[model samples]
Target chain A: MKDRLEIVASGFGGQGVVRLGQTLGEAAVKQGLRVTMLKSHGTEMRGGYVRSQVVLSQKAIDSPMCETPDVFLALSSSAYNRFKDTVPAEGIIVYDPAFVEEIDASLPCRQIAVPAKDIAVRNFKRPIFSNAVALGSLAKLLETMLEKNVVLESFLEVIPKYKDENRNAFEMGYETMNI
Target chain B: MKRFLETGNFAITEGAILGGCRFFCGYPITPATELAEAMSLRLPQVNGVYLQAEDECAAMHLCIGASLGGMKSMTATSGPGFILYADPYGWALGCEAPMVVMNSGRVGPVSGITGAPGQGEFYLTRYPTQGGNFETITLAPNSAQECLKIIVEAFYLSERLRMPITVLGDQLLTDGMEDISVPENDDEMKEMGLRVWPRLYHKGPDFYPASDALDIPPVQMGYDTGALCSDWTPTVEGYDIEEVEEHHKHAYRLIYKVRNNPQLYEDFYEKKYMDDDPDLVVVSYGTPSRVVNTAVERARSEGLKVGALRLINLWPFPDRHFSRKTKYLVVELNWDGQLVREVQRAAPKDAEVKFLGCCGDLPTIPDLMETFTKMLKNQPLERKGWVLEAW
Candidate 1:
């Protein structure tokens, strides 16, 4: 089997999709793995589809763009419906249960539904921290490339002002994963 | 060093510092104005001089003068500002002064959107600046990270080749944000041998001063009056009509010397892909080239024998590399097929050169793939405007 793992984090604008991909890429880099991150954003600043693809590999990354995603994270219903077909059959699809209600169960892929938004606003007191929560859960699932503490530290480095709330969000995400 | 988060503007400032740019002169233009603003704030800390000229013309002239004065100098501007500096830029090309100009292009024919990105200046850039045998080295960077690398290389190439170098970027690359690792000090820069700006003009007692007539000397603002000359004739001590032939010969020599020594091109792929026996070749440059490469790889996986050729240097056109074995040629550019004519001229007459063009300010990877996929299936290509159609 190939040692490369392709992860695509997609959601509406301001949902921190790009940041989540960047954090995972940074974590992989800290672990001595080659990483490439590609992101696309819409013209509008808010409420548009934002997606980022992160490729983690042991060898040099030949191309940064991802043709097929191994782990697909969809934070919005529109994003899930739009990109669900691009997910590989053997891959995993993670969705925010609060927003994404319907996922095609016919596709041969594992699914994980988590209350990512409610946990962020209620436990962390910041709805924006939901991205960090999603990222923490992703780090736990992709156990080979990243560690929970490493993702938490990367989040803290980027969001130093809200360290305690971010920590709580990370813990909630990690516990939700039940890893 | 303060660990504050840096934007693309500040990253360019850091690049200028690392590139040993001792002087900066510019007039404000959107997208590129931040580069000047950051230089004004940071250059003083490094003991470098920064000046705001009356306009882009004066800005480019000041930069050329500073470079001639044995200092590493630069300037920044957008499309409208770039048009104003055309005359002085031609002068710099004729004089072979080493300098760098960062053009953060925005939407424009005259003055379009100040904030949006545009690649409309592709043809203007490829056109010969001085109407002679000279070639200007232009580097198009796609991302902010490439912006820093290209700036450093631009300085090195300009000094080593003794010609004006341009870093062509759009509002996307210039205004976009990304994380980059800045070099610690100028030691790495010095090791690159780029700091040899004030080149030694003499060795021992037998000294020949650097002159604009023979040696292209560095001249300060208020230097010796004898060093300045606007006359077309070359005289030993002063201007004279009898030495007109000598001046023409010297100018031809400078132009031909640069034509002989072209800049280094980072061909995106190896010859295995661009070998003599390719079914079809898709040609692109800058960020779009990256997307084309991806599409080519995808097509290859599906059993389509296709290849791509990307140009790191748009000028000098790499005439030596084109061969007869190459088949269909498709030119993909952001402008309305600006570079297609040049590509057609460079290829064999029998070769069919097609244009897959766009002028939508920014062309995405998917858009390019869609167009390429259709072309590979033998579909007719779309033409953009009267200009491309005329060709």
Candidate 2:
């Protein structure tokens, strides 16, 4: 990261929204960047609105959250709806169209829709790996700041199990370089 | 030597282990549960014992018992659970036992939302227990790295002064993750003066474990040391004493242990861009301090004479930090205004004081930037706290 890149990953509980932020944060740390991540979830464990704020900077990250994010990655429509209008005109939004049904055109930011869950379920038969797919999509969309390979390697390090399947899911989403 | 991306709770667990916390007696609570989980797995690899108590009260007593047996002990809890551990905490103080208590404070009064962050237990960490007046050191670290560093200090301050110490980590910090560097090897730790106090051992045939040296951990209970661990004021021989004059000596030692040694139990603060005597200095701790730091820089870039003082040591009030010529703006994560009251009492009389606080969310950068800008122009504060819409 050059100065500071604020990233927000939002989805329902068990959708691995927090894990996506963590994987990105861990990769940033390994890349010699300062990183801070705060994960918030509702009372419901399964379907609650879950959000993780990841801030990366060349210098120490004083705070993690920003009202206008540099990147917003949404796995669910509720997640996208909750934070759609929050990003600035220069910011970017990477959403998995498999879950996010609607997008606000007035958001005034670059928007890309990736079928991350669809790719995960169709290729690996495991929707749980959708987070890794979404992360790969996000990395590709924000490729100028972060390296796609570095993000994938960090996911491998963070998720100890289901190695081959998770990597495949990330690759499948990474192949969708249309953003 | 190595950097690891870990949560504040994970940092605390490793920090305690590095500081020689061989015994962890804790009851899990939200935001603090992961600390216990990490300890349960990590402690055993280092030949330490991780005991899961039924409740916070029992956890506090268990730590006391372990400390008495010559083990550096710790117990982790949140707001409601910390209250349960209060009475046993008093016992630890009265007996002059050295232990560390981790309070991952949450929104509270009753069983508030466990996920939400708050500095609700700011005062509770210091004077939670009833009875005789005693002083304890409380440390508030803003980052995961600081969490790892201060917990080692927590164990040290507790043992060196022979009293309990509290490390307050709010939910925002505790549950969050950050990149931090910890002492990965013995040499690195040694260079940083990471010392662990060994338990007190009585080698004599008629040895009294709980003698005058109740300050340190007593003899191993299995070794047959005549140690009567009592909450009441005790004699040099470890027996309870009812006399007022004798109690005076005992009480005086306990109360003045950390208070008298100002140099040893001194405060730790962070001052960024305050060299030229700024007109307004934002005072805060824990997670909210991060935003204030950002706001200070934002305000500074705009030619506003603004600075920040992040209080590392919460207790002893760090009254020495505030001075004249520069006014103070107190920021915190609680509605009770605990930090402002301290600022009002300790800061210079001529210094103008302001308060900005919240419970669930932190004081954001934009709100603080505006507040600092208005305060510099002598504009009245729009709201009690720093939220923008309401202000």
Candidate 3:
């Protein structure tokens, strides 16, 4: 985190969008990076659109909310459509190809596709573990600022239980990313 | 020892435990509900009690009773629940029971949007109850770590002042997660004055006549349920008295305890960039101050002489933190200019006070930077003074 960088995970609620960002934030903090994660949820509990903006910096973070995210993780198609136009030109977009079908590549950002949900369902027999896969992919995109072990440790710290499958899903996602 | 990553609500609960809060009575509400949840889990580990009351009203009554029974107590709520608390809240003030309330305010009039952050309760915290010459101590924490630190202060001040103290945050701050640095040693926490003093578990009879303002040892309610703690005027000796002299002495004491002791209950504020002699100073409290920090830095990068002042303590309005020579901009997340009225009132007569307030949504740094830029150049504002939503 040179100046300040924000990573946003956007998806329909219950995809663990907030948890993905929260795990990253906690991992960043474990590395002594200043981090703030802002949770956004619709009034209705589950199935509604949800997003979380996690800002990390070497110094103190002034604003908790992120205007333009450096790394945008789209777990759903609606999530990809919502922020494609808003991401900065040099920013990167990481989307789950299994969920996000369409992408406007001309929007001036690097787009990387990962089969997060597919891998989670096939390997673990649980779609809920997609958040871990998504988080691991997000960490790959943020590798310059956060190490792979740091992200894995954060997942273990935050997940509370089911360490083995989450770890396998995370490793699969991490291996899928080229970064 | 390493500091843990915590949400604002969890940090408050952890800090309350460090502050020696032995009793927690609260009802569930969004944003603030986690504080109650955390308390239910953690209080028992510290040998404390956690009671989930039926409603905000009953929650506060239980809080009052717990504190009277001689344990540092607390409760948590949000916009609508905070309003429900006013009934018993007044008696807590009259009886001078030391209690801390953590209110994570949300967008509201009545059970409004639960996720959006709002500062509508800023003024409500000051005058929580009706018909009394009472003063409230309120602290607004901007981050998870500050949420922890500030709650400890809230509990400390409530005990020191013998009044209900409030820690005012918002949905953003409460739900927001961050790595918070805390004291490594419990001994350090005690040495730093985070310990509770009022463990009045079993004071003998005749403890009722003690003066709360004087910081005299208090009696347990189990000994005397009618410990002269009625909402009505009480005699200095701790009994109901409707007589003129007794009422005069009683009410004034309630007000003067905070007024005369600036050394004790004075406003706590944090000032930044004032030494740089900035042309414009932004005043804000709670989560809005985070945006002001960004705007201030952005303004400096753009070569504008701008600074920021964040109010950690909301009540007793720390006007003394202002530099009268500089133009001031007051920002908040409430419509109709409730806090700006205080900015206008407390700021020096010669100082120019500008208001840029928004409700239902947060004020962005770009908007603040643009407004401050216009104000700095003496340019006619596109909008100024209580910029309400276009009705």
Per-residue alpha-carbon lDDT of candidate 2 for residues B253-351, written as tens digits (9 for 90 to 100):
766666677665564678898788888999998888988888898889999988888988888777877756577888878766788878887987777
| Candidate 3 CAPRI assessment class | medium
* Candidate 2 C-alpha error for residue A131, in Å: 1.6
Per residue, candidate 3 scores C-alpha lDDT tens digits across A10-100 of 9888888887887888888888889898887777788888888889888878788777888899878888898777689888899988889
Q: Which lDDT tens digits does candidate 1 get at residues B1-391?
A: 2222234566677777777788999998777877999999989998999999999999989888887676788998888998887877777765556788888777667876665566667666654254554456677766555566678777767766656777777665565444445666556545533232344221122111223233333332234434332324334343334354666654664555556555354341233266545677777665555556766776777776778776656665666555654544444435556667777778888776776654533344555566566666767655435345543
Greater-lDDT candidate between 1 and 3: 3
Q: What lDDT tens digits, residue by residue, belong to model 1 across residues A1-179?
A: 25778888888888988778877766776666766665555555678777777777886554455656888999999888887887788888889988798878887788888788989988767689898788778878887657777777877876677788778787788778854
lDDT of 3 by residue, B1-391 (tens): 3477778988898889888899999998998878888999999999999999889999999999888878899999998999999888998988778899989988878888788788889889999998867777788989887777778888777776777898899998998888877675677676554554544443453433323355544445665444556767766555776778777766786777777677664446777787777899999998899889888988888889998988887787776676377788889887667777787778787888787877766787778988899899987556554545531
Q: All models, DockQ values? A: 0.11, 0.70, 0.73
DockQ of candidate model 3: 0.73
| Residue B189, candidate 3: alpha-carbon lDDT | 70
What is the Å distance of residue B257 in model 1 from its true position?
A: 4.8
Write the candidate numbers in order of decreasing TM-score: 2, 3, 1
In the range A31-143, model 2's lDDT, one tens digit per residue, is: 88888999887667789888899998898788777567888998888889988888889898898888988778777898988888888888888789888788877877768
- How well does each candidate superpose onto the true structure, as a TM-score? 0.74, 0.93, 0.92
What value does the TM-score of chain B take for model 3? 0.91
Worst-scoring 10-residue span by lDDT in model 3 chain B: B203-212
